[model samples]
Target: ITLPLSAPGIAFSLVLVFLLAIGELSVPSFLRYPVLPVLSFTQFAASYNFGAATAAAVPLAALALLGVLIESALLQNRVFTFRSIGRGLLISLGRWNPIAAAIFGLLTVALVIFPLSALFADAFSLTTLHDAMQRAGASIVRSVIYSAIAATILMALGFLLAQLTRDRGQRLVNFLTLALFAIPGTVLSIGLVRLWNSPMTWFIYTTPALLILGYTAQYCAVTTRLSLAGFFLIPKTFDEAARLSGASWTQRLFRIFVPLSNRTLVCAWLAAYILCLRDVPIALMTASPGGDPLPARILTLMANGAPPMIASLCLIMAIASLIPLVILARVIPSRGITG
Candidate 1:
């Protein structure tokens, strides 16, 4: 049926949205919400007790892990395989098709385009934008650099793990990533602090590397899933033929797999980049003494800054999120990723 055929795409979308949702800190902080991420953040930020913060985060982490387990069970073979023989008859709208299309178009405009247009219209002003730039310029640059580093590391590690999806350790690897992904950023940041706060690892821990590691641990599974989708699309016969031709493993991977999977790798990188750029919880918790990422800085400024300036910063972040989506849309079509 069309439902089964489309399940993987739906599941992927759900996972992406879920990851972004559970890790969000700014909105919850702003709205005085009881969300898990905000709870963890307040516990540490207010009290400075790592143990109390981690304890508060444990239940939320468990819930997230359970969500992942449920998703894995529901989406197991459905996600990895796209081919199926069952077909459902298409219901044609016939004379109403045009009317339906028009309604859909209007709905899209009302929901996505209109809200964005309003945000831009209200948020844009030279003086406010300049103020935002002055306040957030360094943080923005840091966000980009950190995101790039995190995305690169995630894509590399994810590629290796994705290649081993059919191996014996796949389930264990998947479970580990899921568990890490589920852990509240505050909890993970505290764990990282405890592990690296020691004298030996202090150098890297005190640097931006800690933030990059947090991002990688949280989002690597997303990259792995994206890369694995591409890997699965490629027929095993290509590898078999290359092997028969006496090509080395490196030769096959470089000459064949990498070239074919280029689109997937790019998609994964862009995904990770956007995740890091918009992240607040990890950025807040893992930031160095004098430095904070743009998202975290924005959250801080929003409490005290003028509404216009805050709007402008939020607008920039919104645009940052949209850019990768546009790139993915264009690249996917050109690269023939039909799903």
Candidate 2:
């Protein structure tokens, strides 16, 4: 019975995972998986064949657009009753519980625990972590700064977009974000390069602004969606009462809507920041020649880097991602998790 209502969430999740898989760069490149993103990057960066790169990305571009359209359709002019999840009765697992637990435990060990253990052992050796810090300190700091700026911009825009589309989804904004996100990062970087490469726009192209723009364009979809969920939780009556008393839209937004949705706002910012921090192709393509972010630095070191050194670099990346993720976990209410 719950499955019927779950269909929308399940479909969105499937599309989300599909887009992530298609946009992924590191694992596919490292494992030599011949994925679309890798092929597109190679065509654009290595071969200098823009036409071929664009052609290779057509399928994923369509796929990302389809996901956005489906998302809009799911949300279009509808009041989401996510709380209705409680209406269904739980099915008892009986004897299958222990078997299910064992399967999950083994999978967790194999997929998560074992790999992390290996990475920890290799990364924490004498001088490895220190060396990684020394080598990538500037890059890590730069990543954080860039991620911060981009996240702030994204958060503001996401809130505004969420407000604009409170009743209906914003088609153009959604489409633009999907284009930047679904299309090859390399292709987007190249487009940015061409757009702002000239002396007139040197300030943007030569600085971290270019990287921030790429991050904003790609992740706007994500932050907006997250923000919209928070927006939905707000009572329209609150806004109405404030307006009747002559509270400006800005005042109500900052004083009422914002505080009520503070948790989700933070979640949106954190999500955008992490996405920006971990991105590879865009940073690699747009970063200053000597000032690559940690992810970009890892790729650079991968060719001739020692095992310990690479592991340490990767460990630093993991830690950077983990701190925010931990906070995200905490900020989420237990009821939210159960729901």
Candidate 3:
């Protein structure tokens, strides 16, 4: 009846409100109805129950406290002095310690090369490799497209936002951008789910669009930071020079600012793409039940007791993700690209 009586906006808002209410109500229902009964049953089984769980927790807490105290004592005794530790690490890795240096060099090579090699091997394995490839074939292509679209949207938004704000307001914008860095991916996922879990937002929740949205919200700040840095690097003089040359604002940006910041823009795009590729927590949480990105699929495989397959899948993804990073590293010069 309410659905029929309402307009689109009202109906959508009502549906969201209903879901929020359901989520809110489920908490107390779980605690009072289920949790209390379970607690009572456990208490009866223990027989001497003076809240045995709570009592057991106390000893564990004391042991944790003792460990912390010992750590503090060792730290206070200069066992972890910053300068001394730094000097020791430097000496250990330096040529003065040839064996240590050799060990360190081998470790570094293993760290860098082993993962890629393992992934390459796994990607070619007879049984699992074929299955993972088939599973991820179209989805990998779609994820790349989705990532590119999201990065473009983010770059555009960041540029517009930077252009609209004054120097003083930019500080405030920067603070807000930095603030997002503190929000964990899971928290952002919950917020996205809550915001879009409505009949009207069914498309977002059901499609890969929600994954894109989650990635955008989490990494908008990174895009803003990269673009803003690029923006600053393009001198105010360039804008003035363009204006005096009879170029409009759009022309000035297209011909001057953007051309000058091409490297930064590419770097930003690379950062966004790499982040989107590796983003496991948010992707896992937001992915549609039917379709998931490579990272999420790897995680799902792991959870379903397929370690060898997961390892193989992970190796393939690591290689795939590395291709962009390697390209970006090669393309971006140490010196800035100026118009």
Candidate number with the higher TM-score (1 or 3): 1
Model 2 Cα shift for residue 310 (angstroms) = 0.6
Task: Give per-residue lDDT, candidate 3, residue 201.
Answer: 86
lDDT of 3 by residue, 1-339 (tens): 544543444543454344323222113323554333223223423353635534433433343334334333333311110111222222233555888778889998899778667656555667876676676666667667777888787777666666655254665665455434334444455557668989998988898889888888777766776676667666788788778889997887788777777776777787788878777656666788867777766655564635456667777677778899898767654453222
Q: Which segments of model 2 are wrong by more than 4 Å?
A: 73-90, 168-172, 335-339
Report every candidate's CA lDDT. 0.79, 0.79, 0.60
The lDDT ranking, best first, is 2, 1, 3
In model 1, the runs with Cα more than 4 Å from the true position are: 1-23, 81-115
Question: Model 1 TM-score?
Answer: 0.85
Q: List the residue pairs that clash in candidate 2.
A: none
How big is the positional error of residue 179 in model 2, measured in Å on the Cα after superposition?
4.6
Q: How well does model 3 score by local distance difference test?
A: 0.60
* TM-score for candidate 2: 0.89
Q: When superposed on Cα atoms, how far off is each prediction in RMSD?
A: 3.7, 2.9, 16.7
lDDT string for model 1 (105-181, tens) is: 99999998897787787687998889889989888888888898999999888888877774457777777887787
- Preferred candidate (lDDT higher): 2 or 3: 2
